[model samples]
Target: MLSPGDTLSDFTLEGVDENGEINTFTLSELTDDAVAVLNVYVYDYSPVCTDQVCDISELEWLGINEDVNVVGISGDGPYSHQQFIEDNRIGYPLLCDTAEEIIEELGVLHEEKDGLRRVPQRSIFLIDSDRVVRWKWVAEDNWDEWDSGPIEALNDTISQIRA
Candidate 1:
């Protein structure tokens, strides 16, 4: 339930590299001087989640946005994430949160229908250099429509921040 202007908590997350090696990173360490496009999904290989993240990867401007970094996050382990990345041909990093620490910290984890804790909803957060969430999107159900509006809003916010 974090909102715009809310400062993010300290989080040390593991992200896999191109070679599928695990790399540890912290939120405070990575947020400085950068804009992050964060996608928190329910599972690694789920259809809706994969489509959402892969579509994000297809955003042409992301590769050229030197000030921005695109990262997808899930509670899955690094191995599963590695496979997902390779299968999906994801060009960006897939953050590993096997224990769902970040998800629980962000208050997104909830009781799922399958008897396990799944990220309650698909949400996106646009965090600016200062580590404040500038844009956010939340969906209650998998069928919820979340288009590129968050990205557009993020671009607008980034422009304003630079101005």
Candidate 2:
């Protein structure tokens, strides 16, 4: 798993922007001028995932933090991400990892019991403008109840980094 201080390489992926348009975006583009919070979730509309994204989207500090870019990544496609953004009023861009390449590379890929399905393990990575990871949190177990503390911690970390 990627840890704090590891440098993340730039990668391109299709993402649904805040305006609900699908576009190709590279990691460098998102992090070049700002710190980035990479929120990796299991699925778009899954109950916990929905709550997770919504919590991040509604963070008050995020509205004022132009220097922090929060981007979500999941195996769902662009159409799903667009609907998710519209349905939940998500303010951040959600990238599609349909190929699972990024998820696997980040060591967050989760496989199902049946061995037929794979998804991203719920995780978050904070990367600074230099592409070095400053913080990382990965779920210990996939089915654990959702916790809002991590999101708050992420916000606090962003503030500390920019301070």
Candidate 3:
């Protein structure tokens, strides 16, 4: 499992744009001068996931951090992600972790919840320009008591960390 100050492995995934066209997210690309907010979630249109994604744009202070690059990742394929983006008006790029390779590699896989397996645990990672994970949160369970989106808690932590 990754920890604070541990640099993450550079990984790329097939991403999708608002137009449903093929997009790509290479972690190395964002490490130059930005703190990337890795928004990892479950299915694309799942209720909690939908609310979380929709609420991201409301995080206006994201600009407070140096160049916030928000990327939403899930097991949903590119097509589904495209639809979700169009439906939810997600302003950020969404990566399709259909094979769960990245999820498993990061050890954030929420296994076998009610017979469903390979669900990407609702988690977030703040990868600063150094490519180091400066802050992270993995819900002990699903998003029930754990609000996994980029909430005030994360913003406060990031502000303090970067201050």
- Angstrom error of the Cα, residue 151, model 3: value is 1.6
Question: lDDT per residue, candidate 1, 39-141, as tens digits?
Answer: 8887887877888888888887677877777788887788888888888888788888878877776667777777665564688887777788888877778
Clash number for model 1?
0
Off by over 4 Å in 3: 18-20, 62-66, 114-116, 143-150
TM-score of each: 0.87, 0.95, 0.87
In candidate 2, what are the lDDT values of residues 1-163, reduced to their tens digit?
7788888888999999989999998888888889888999999889888888898898886789788888999999999999999999999999998999988888899787778988789999998888888988898866677889887788778878877
TM-score result, candidate 1: 0.87
- Compose the digit string of candidate 3's lDDT tens values, residues 1-163: 7778888888899998556678788988866677788888887878877877777745676445456788888888888887888887777789988888878766788676577655888888888877888888876666664353447777877677667
Better of 2 and 3 by lDDT: 2
* Top model number, lDDT: 2
Error of 1 at 139 (Å): 1.3
